[model samples]
Target: MAAETAAPAESARTWLVGLVRRTAFAVRAALSRRDGRATAVTVAAAYLVAYHLGLGHLGLRAGAVVSRPRFDLVVVEDPVALATRRVAPFQYEPVALLSAGPVEYLFAPVNAVVGLALAGLVGVTLAVSVVAWRGPAACRIGAGAGAAAGLPGILSGVACCGPAFLAVIGVQASAGLLAAFRWFLPASVAGLLLTLLWVGSQVDPAAAR
Candidate 1:
C-alpha cells in the first residue's frame, strides 16, 4: 500500500509541474501576441508599476521629517543612531519583533527582479487609488474598491521594504485600511473629504478645516 501510494503521489507531482510549465508558456505566447516582445512588455510594465508603487511613500515622504530608509535589514539598537527625535513613529522598526525575513523566497537574481516588479504593482494600485479619489461622485467608490482589491502590499510592507524605493506600501496601508472597511460609496466620500484635508494640511493648518 505504501509503495502504491508513493507511486501515485509522484505521478501527481509530475503531472502538476508539467501542467504549470505548459500553462506559463502558453500564457507568455498569448500575451506576447506572437511578435515575441512579451518579456520586454513585462519588464517595461513592471518598471511603470514600481515607479507608482514607490509613490505611496509620498505621503510619508511628505509627512516625515526624516526621509532615510534603513536598508540591509541590519539591526540598529542604538537610539543615537536614529539621530532624530522624530523617529518615524509611523515607521515600523521592530528590532525585537519581526516575522520571517524573505531570504529563501527569492533565491535567484531573476527571482529577485521579478519580485521587484511586484513594487510596480503596488504603485499602479495606488495610482489607481489616487485616481479613484478624483473623478466624480463615483470616483471615491471606484478608488476604494480598486485599492481594496489590488493591495496586498497593505500589510506585507512590514517585512517587504527591501527595495527601498517601493516604500509606498509602508506608508499607505493606513489609508488603504481606511478605504477598505468604510463601504465603497461612504468610504469614498469620507476618503475624498479626508484627502482634501490632507492636501489642505499641506498648504495651511487652518485651510485643513
Candidate 2:
C-alpha cells in the first residue's frame, strides 16, 4: 500500500528527468551538425573553463595576489586611505557580474533567478561542448564532468553568474565561424571572449556602487 502511494511521485520525477535528457540530446545534435573545427574549439573551451575553475578552487584571488610596486615600493597601503584614492586597484570594487555591470542589471533579483539561469547555462554549455567535440567517448566524459561541476554550483547558486553564458555564446559562434574560416575562427572566438571577460572584470559600472 505504501509502495503504491509512492509510485506516482517517483513516476513524475522520472518523467521530468526524461524530458530534460531529450531536450539536451536534441540541442547537442543540432549544434554538432554545424562545422569542422567546432568540436575541437568547444572541447578546448571546456578544458580552459575547467582549468580556471580548478585554480579558483585552489583560492586564487586578486585580493590575495601580492602586488609588487612597478617603479617604487610602499611597505603598506591602508585600506581606508586607498578607498579615497583615485583609481585604486581593481578588486577594491564589488562586482555583480564580475564587479557588476549589464549582466547584474539585467539579471536583477540577481540572487535567485540569475542563479537558476547560470546553473542552466553551465549545464547547457557542457552539453554543447560535448556535442561540438565529436567522438562518443570524449563527449560522454565532457558531459559527465560538466554535470558534476555544474550541479554543485547550481545547487549552491555559487559562481553561477561568472562569464559562463558568454563562453557558451563564444563556443556557438566559434562553430559557425570556424565552419566558414579555417583555424582562424577558433582563435578569433576565444580572443574575443577572453578580452570581454578580462575587461569586464577589471573595468567598472552599475553594481551597487
Candidate 3:
C-alpha cells in the first residue's frame, strides 16, 4: 500500500514539474518578442479600461447585501451626483463624493499619462525578467509582480468612492466609504517602483544563476 501511494505521488510531482517547465518556456518565448510585449500592454490597458468603466463587475450593481458601518465618502458614476449631502443621524454621512465623470473627463489627459506609464513599467519589467531568467519563469514573475503593483490603482479606480475594494467582488455600494484614489495614488506609484526593484533583484546573477 505504501509503495503504491509513493509511486503515484512521484508521478504527480514529475508531471507538475514538466508542466511548469513547458509553461515557462512558452512564456519566455512570448515575452522575448516585441509584438508579444505590445500585445500584453494592449491587453493590460483593455483590462484597466474595462475595470474603470465598471465592467469588471460584469454589469452587476449589488451582489450580496450585508450590514456594515457607514463610510465617510461615496463614489458615484454620474457627475451630477458628485456633491455631498446628509444621510442619517448618528450614522456617518458622506462629506465628499467622487464622480467618475470628472475622473474620466476633467482628468482625461492624466488617464492617458498613467496608462502610458503603466504600459512602460510592465514592458520594462518583462524585458528585464526575460533577460535574467530566460524562460517562462521570468514571465510569470514579471506578470505577478506587475499585477501586485498595479492592484492599488485598479482597486482605487474601481472603488473610488463606493465601498472600499468591495466592488471588485460584486458588493453593493455603501455610504461613507472613502475615495480609494485619494490614498491609492501615491501607494500605486510606490508599489510600482518597489516591484521594479524587487523584480530586478530577482534576476541578479550574484543571487542566483
lDDT of each: 0.35, 0.34, 0.43
RMSD of each: 19.1, 18.7, 16.1
lDDT digits (tens) for residues 1-209 of candidate 2? 99998999899887555544544443444245544135434543554345234213212333332443222212223434443332211112211222121111211122223233333344444444344344323223332332232222222221321233335446544555333333332343343333222222221222102
Candidates sorted by lDDT, best first:
3, 1, 2
User: What TM-score against the true fold does each predicted structure earn?
Assistant: 0.29, 0.23, 0.38
Best by lDDT: 3
- Model 1 clashing residue pairs (backbone): 49-120, 50-120, 52-123, 53-123, 57-168
Q: How do these models rank on TM-score, best leading?
A: 3, 1, 2
- The candidate 2 region of ten consecutive residues with least summed lDDT is 99-108
Off by over 4 Å in 3: 1-31, 34-39, 51-107, 122-176, 205-209
Give the per-residue lDDT of model 1 (tens digit) for 54-132.
Answer: 3232122222233343222334475344433222222222222111222111122222343355444333334433433
Q: Local error of candidate 1 at 78, Å? A: 14
Best by TM-score: 3
